[model samples]
Target: MSSEPTHQNIHTFDQATALQPAGPHHWKGQPGRLYWNMVGPFGGTTAATLLHAVLLHPERIGEPAALTVNYAAPLADLPFVLEARPLRTNRSSQHWLLLMTQVDTEGQTITVASGTAVTALRRGTWAGSELPHPPVTPAENLSPRPPTAGLAWSERYDLRLLDGDLPTAWDGAHADDSLTRLWIQDLPPRPIDFLSLAAMSDMFYPRIWRRRALRTPAGTVSMTVYFHADQAALAAAGSGPLLGEARGQEYRHGFFDQRAQLWSADGTIMTTTHQLVYFRD
Candidate 1:
């Protein structure tokens, strides 16, 4: 929506960090919103994750800040290859756009997903204010709690709770306002940047639905991403943690309304996401 620029983001952005490196995890199977619903896919959260990953490092773009992601959505079963390039370089900030789509080969692309991120030129140093960083602890300090005891979506990523007694599989703890803190990171061959975070956010519906005692299993309706600032409080504590938070809501019987707030290591509001989810079961 906005093609404006700002100061450099404190986070790191690298072309190398654009996509998760080689790994066993990837989209491959039934092309349906059902899978997207199961993983909380497409929607606003997906673009937010990808944009955040690239903008984290402002120096790469001559130090620009990321504002938000709009006008696009994610897919459930489409193969995608994300390629980003500098659109133009100005005295203030550098502009960039990332082209995402289903790929048939290293050189072939089909329209699937796409987005744009803008950052400003860094002018000075200042301490910023962040929404109350959740009270959750580091992932390594606690035991790994499973989001779903017997679901395929839950097993895809490396997850750890960051706060108040880990959530249980049968707590009936569904409340639209209750926020859960967790470190969602990718393991193995993947470098695990924002892309991994996007993939992980897709699965949050089940946990929220479970707590609220709601059932969902299909359709990805819509999403919006708003990123304010980046801090270090949400990153890994040592070598095994990547901090982040997701907040969303559910509406009607088949529609899911949601909002997400992502933080940094030193308590910065990395980004915010809004999305609509549809259930299948």
Candidate 2:
């Protein structure tokens, strides 16, 4: 159990209707179930909110390398709050804990999800050599449009689809289920940080599931994110916006597979992701 001055300080609130991540994001009343649109905890739930506690502090060093997330449950329409606490802080590395819960008018905290992360400080390997050279649109020529369909987060990033159909997640184009290319750069340069890459990786979820029923939404039990390599380093080398080819789809088995290549600007295969997705549709 790592201890800090504000280790127990949990900032919780109902995420607003828009699922916005600012002051007081909570639920409304009635049928419960968070809202018509609630933020997916993974991508939207960047450990930043949790790290804010420490990164805001003066003595923190290095960036996080590993982050793990597990769904606590379906959040309903109620007052909710989330906070990150440091579980362990040592000389070479750190571990952080995350929790989000629902609170009622009577002031009760129902635990939603608990997550952990391991971060370290060290220069990464691979200096942009040995990776595949992906096509580049350059920030100047990249034109990302708002996702008039699908989830809210998709619209925020100007994504240029490498092969998927249009500004919707439910496109009926399962012919090849090819590699997707999106010009993923934050507004005015959020700068290449660990947080941004984590968020982008979440976008690959729906893309991986664009099979079986491209025109429908699939029920996801719970998805996990594993950061195997550095996306920024790969991007700077211009290897990606790479290709994440959908490898398999088994509707009868309630699963799918997405195999992607993390190439470098010079055309080196940096890393690979073989994602498995489940659907109830």
Candidate 3:
């Protein structure tokens, strides 16, 4: 473990997702109330925490290339254990397996989440983006989303919606589609980094509620994120709000899938994500 002292001015996000080395390939973390959701801590923070472990690992290699997190169960508002193991290492890529476990009231250790990640040494090469950035009003001209009553995590982000705001009334109205485009950034304004990028990937609200206009029960079951931006690209983004777009592909048998992308102000695709979600009738 690095013996560096913690910065006194650490952001709440870093504090909430903070990890302390416990042993080889193991770390301890606790949920913060600031990122709490209805059932537990925000899924985005949880995902970021998992990635944080790998990022801090002494044996870690390269930057993050892809990450897949599976929410196995709700994590209680208590201390938890995170285990990140480098399963394999290659010249240009590394593979990792992650697990978050907590002790239940019954004294049994159970997994709350699991994940796999790939980090790779990127090489300079010719690259191109096929999808052009969508036309949307600048974030400066739009007002930030009001604080959501009960969901503390909503207050952590400055969201300026360009389309598909949450349903004003739960009248069971059905929209033609569930497409949301918005500009979002950390409320206190932090620099763009891989950890924050990972968290933002799961920031969108459940698509089912937006589609049916009903406050149905829904939560993400699994999420996968592909990192497209390199360190230079992220540095160019700075702390500016990213243009986020998301839409539901299908809803069937009490489940649905959401696809989302994050684009920098300069039109570089920072990350793309897809998630499977479960909803109740």
Write down the TM-score of every candidate: 0.55, 0.60, 0.96
Angstrom error of the Cα, residue 98, model 2: value is 2.3
Model 3: per-residue lDDT, tens digit, 153-174? 8878889999999999999999
Model 3 poorest ten-residue lDDT run: 1-10
Candidate 2 lDDT over residue span 8-63, tens digit each: 34211112112324333222222222112344443333333333333443345556
Model 1, poorest ten-residue lDDT window? 9-18
Evaluation by TM-score, superior candidate among 1 and 3: 3
- Clashes by residue pair, model 3: none
> Top model by lDDT, which number?
3
Predicted structure with the largest TM-score when compared to the true one: 3
Can you write out model 1's per-residue Cα lDDT over 76-169, one digit (the tens) per residue?
3544555455567777776666555565445555655555666555455765664687666665666655545544334334566654223444
Q: Which of candidates 2 and 3 is the stronger one according to TM-score? A: 3
lDDT, model 1: 0.46
Location of the lowest summed lDDT over 10 successive residues in candidate 2? 10-19
Error of 1 at 184 (Å): 3.2
Tell me the alpha-carbon RMSD of every candidate.
Answer: 10.1, 9.4, 3.8
